[model samples]
Target: MGMQTTPMIEMDFAVIKEDFSRYLIHDGAILKVKIVVKKILRTAELTAQGYPAGTSIDSVNAVAAIVPQALKREPSKEPWDPRRDVGEEVKFEPQEEKWQEYMTTEGYRILIKPVLTKVFRYNKYNDYGEPIYSAVIQSITNIEKLGTTATT
Candidate 1:
């Protein structure tokens, strides 16, 4: 993939009342900009249909809709355990050709670690009565956060 380049964006807004300068910044070339939004969502109508109560809220639980549901995990023997450590990894006849081919087939960049870690919860009511866990992937989006900076 090619490297990414920054873009020049123009922001236009009207003055609601006053305090206009704080919203805009005049610079040499507008090198960097950080937007501080009052809120992502605009207020719904002050009134609903009849007596105009006020813009109370559009949503009850914000995080409930966005935050991913916790993934369940089934218990399993981990690949690596300190207690079960095999006395120092014994060297075997190196598969040089196969090793090189594997590395080439799957580039290092494609083997990066996962962004989110898995959570495991133990349960003791299965057939054998040991511990078991079930897990699944979850997506993260729609987060409220500070704006980012730009470089030009």
Candidate 2:
């Protein structure tokens, strides 16, 4: 299905300035400069990417472009942290000693204790003829839950 599009609303800045001045000021067409700036900022923010075909150009477009430009020019990621995340999945093959230790460790008690099932799948033989038991552990945390929080 195609995305839905909305027709843009045309605005007259001269009428906006007159109405704002009338509503706010008792003497003259004078609004607090900050308030005027904020109104312009909010209108541009909300109406951004909605300026349809035949929409008259104004300083609002210049204001709107600033947001995307600032986003694009955000400081690049640190060289050391390429992935920006350390969450790695739990794979059972090539299981180290700590892997089996964590299976029954107090840290994972809630997940391991609730299901209380550990079914092993023999994937392949190791170099020294030792069997590789890919332990299909029944735990919700096995996928992306590591290093987030400890059950214990």
Clashes of each: 10, 0
Candidate 2 similarity to native, TM-score: 0.16
Query: Which residue segments of model 2 deviate by more than 4 Å?
Result: 1-116, 121-123, 140-152
Deviation from native of the Cα of residue 64 in model 1, angstroms: 30
Candidate 2 worst ten-residue window by lDDT: 60-69
Instruction: Give the local distance difference test score of model 1.
Output: 0.20
Q: Over the stretch 1-152, how does candidate 2's per-residue lDDT look in tens digits?
A: 99965544433322112111111111111111111111111122232323222322222100000111211222323322323423222222211111111211212211111111222313233333322222122222121122534365
Q: Write the per-residue lDDT of candidate 1 for residues 21-101, one digit (tens) a residue.
A: 111111111111112222112122223322112211111111101111232234344533434433222111211111000
Global lDDT of each candidate? 0.20, 0.22
C-alpha-based local distance difference test score of model 2: 0.22
TM-score of each: 0.16, 0.16
